[model samples]
Target: MAKKLGLKQKYQMMTRGLGWDTTYQSMDKVYPFDKFEGIKVHDWDAWEDPFRLTMDSYWKLQAEKERKLYAVIDSFAQNNGHLGISDPRYLNAVKLFIQGVSPLEYMAHRHFAHVARNIRGIGPAVAAQMQSLDELRHAQTQIHTISHYNKFFDGIHEWRHMHDRVWYLSVPKSFFDDAVTAGPFEFLTAISFSFEYLLTNLLFVPFMSGAAYNGDLATVTFGFSAQSDESRHMTLGLEVIKFLLEQDEANVPIIQRWLDKWFWRGYRLLTLVAMMMDYLLPKKIMSWQEAWEMYYEEAGGALFQDLARYGIKEPMSAAVARKEKNRLSSEAWAIFYQYTHAAAFHTWDIDEEHKAWLAEKYPETFDKLYRPRLDFWEKEAAAGRRFYNNALPQLCTVCQIPMGFTEPDDPTTICFRESEYKGEHYHFCSDGCKGIFDNEPEKYVQSWLPVHQIFQGNCGGASVEDVLKWYRMNLGADNLDFSGSPEDKFWSEWHRTASRAEAAE
Candidate 1:
């Protein structure tokens, strides 16, 4: 905060200024060469987290920032600032944010905590510890940012319990769970390298921009502050990959496959964010197509080109990634529309403007594949019937996302991968989950699917009402309909006062 420090300057602070070489260095460095696989490290310093600040500097800045932000959230909620938003339509975007992202940050916190514990390198380990705290801060900041909306929204209260036992919640739970169980190198690849470095902007930036457009300063500030931290997290991910590659030749092939597998897996999982960007945000920041083309296709494409000099092939070949990106927005929208009643967010039919946006953004497939369904839904809405179908189909055991993804590049075909282990069947949402399960069926089967929990009577009861009550108490599912909540009451009264003030003026 003293002055604007660019990435290079920060790197110098952490890796150069604080880095010390001792003459009495132990025979084995804190991060030793991999003897079992015959991997050798030419130089550990080659592994560098680009956004480098020492632990003391990191904590001081981060703590001061969090204190300021949390105070804002407290003031906003207490003073009924949610009513000051430009329109109720803005809440729709915030609702989507709470549902899709808030819980994921918590999960990321858990995994980063684990990484801080288990990783061998003192430098990487300490960096991960800093990230572990950063993630928890992110989780808290997200909750606080959205809690103002929570006062007015229906589903914000029960998020924590839902994250563990809700069917949709499993998407994030499974993603992080997969990482937590992997070898140290792989955990780094999955979480730090692939998700943070490559695709996190796809998840966070649009929502922040939308919040800004919709006149939600708290959400925008919180998002930017957290993303400022993400710059560091991304550097850690890139550094982990570089360190692994340089550590051992034997590590290269293994790391390559992980890079391929995880990049696709994380990208596929981010379809929810893609859908949220396109449909849920009332004010469009950018279409999912545009974001993906720029962020994934161009930026990620360039990163792969640079990595190729080190014998690293682009993970998840460009042809397949491009194909997936083309279909991701509309396909994810269809799935979200189908299942949103069970979700914390609400879904509405695509209006003519939304359709026009889609047509412009996704020219090739929108008209042919998804438009008819949108038309049908619009008609259904016009018939005095709001759609609210809450029944869920079977869920994937591994990824925990719904079984809605269609086969790669084939939007018409449902993409569900199945594997049998020891005479039992395990389901996956995509090839990524399937491959992960196959690699370790023993691990995947132990996943705590929410639906399975209900069947096992671990939740409230077999009855739907009983289950809902249990979900409310455990998962923070408080007053879900805004019109009936205290936030709505405050909003109504504030508007009335505003009208009186205008007349008095």
Candidate 2:
């Protein structure tokens, strides 16, 4: 054999010799969108991907992992694996995944494709290309993994439509849409740094662990597989942030602004995740407050300390986020519990045991601030009347979540902020959302707010049933209280039948 090539040499050979001088057209004309964002890239070659992956090696590794993943999926499907889950209630977490998160993978795929094509450097471009494929794979695998559950579940069949039209889903959709619409550098900063590196573990870990604890083997497999790729994506995020900061001191403030804005946006989007972790899973892994402290406060504290050498401090409103960690999950679940009839997922009052668990998990806030509300709801439920908030709740113009979050200092009052643009009033759920809108009013004013669309006759007809029909919700089956719902009835009957067979044997 001839001389063997080293990994770094092969990466360079594949990435370095790919670009050509353009005498026929100007560089700016070729890449028109790169300059408008005010990013300064003095040397494109200065950008280095830490992964050092060539296309050949990349395909080989990905193919092997996917083959292993599909093998597990097939085995699960042929054996009636759905019956082995901890409870039917656990599938609600899967429904939330397919509805709220799977489509985001596809959106990430689309944006990464744009980044791959538009950016001028070969190293970054190739990295983006790999990430684009990784995201597309994640979307497909998530859907494929969850499709087995759809054979027996209610809310999963219409997830694509639900992602577009559901009220809670608008939170994630709007957050990704904000990132996808920005210029290239800002898009990378928004997604790669803020979302993937800083906040992704908080989103993925609990769901994966919950799946495992609930005996959903297929979901656990897929979650683990998707997270393996997340490591590379996280590396890419850190590299990009450092590369930008190293390139020019002027790039610092712009990145810090994007960091602050996207950090809060990503946190607000995770409010749904917090609720799912705390309230939805039948067998809980860790409390939302504990997970936040472990993942965000402890780990993120170290990350910021490392970045501080480059003049990057923690995000603005870090204090508010820290304070709300104790309270956001309860607040979000309460909103879902009241308005669940208008949603695609199910919700119900936690029993006394679960309430005690909450008290133990959130000693500072649960019994004092949140448990009384749960107590009142449980009483109402016992007396043969369940409380439901029928009137439409106002949505934040930016994040598109309901205005149910309370002020940080005083947890009694809802934190509401407003701005007037062109003599039309706009409302925000917090100062963070208002700040995002004020900085880019033109962008957010054009938001396709779900509530506004429902009122203006754009989403089905004007009635709640009409709106539910538009969302493809199955009413009593898919939405609303889960105590006596189809899923609950099925689970009870499942265990009862198994017991009867055992006794007969």
> Residues 358-393, candidate 1, lDDT per residue (tens digit)?
888888888998899889877876786545456756
User: Which residue pairs show collisions in model 1?
Assistant: 154-480, 157-476, 158-475, 158-476, 158-477, 406-415
lDDT of 2 by residue, 1-505 (tens): 3388787677778776666657899988888888888888888889876888888898899899899899999999997688889988888889999999999999999999999889887788888889999999999999999999888778999999899988888888888998999999999998888899999998899889999999999988988788778999999999999998998898888888898899999999899889988999999999988888999999999999999988999987778998898889999998999998887778888888988999999899999989999989989999988999989999999999999999989888999899999998999998889999999999998998998999999889999999899888888888988888888888788778777877999
Error of 2 at 281 (Å): 1.4
Q: What TM-score do all the candidates reach, one by one?
A: 0.84, 0.97
**Per-structure clash totals for the candidates:** 6, 0
Error of 2 at 470 (Å): 1.0
* TM-score (C-alpha) between model 2 and the true structure: 0.97
Weakest 10 consecutive residues, lDDT, candidate 2?
A: 12-21
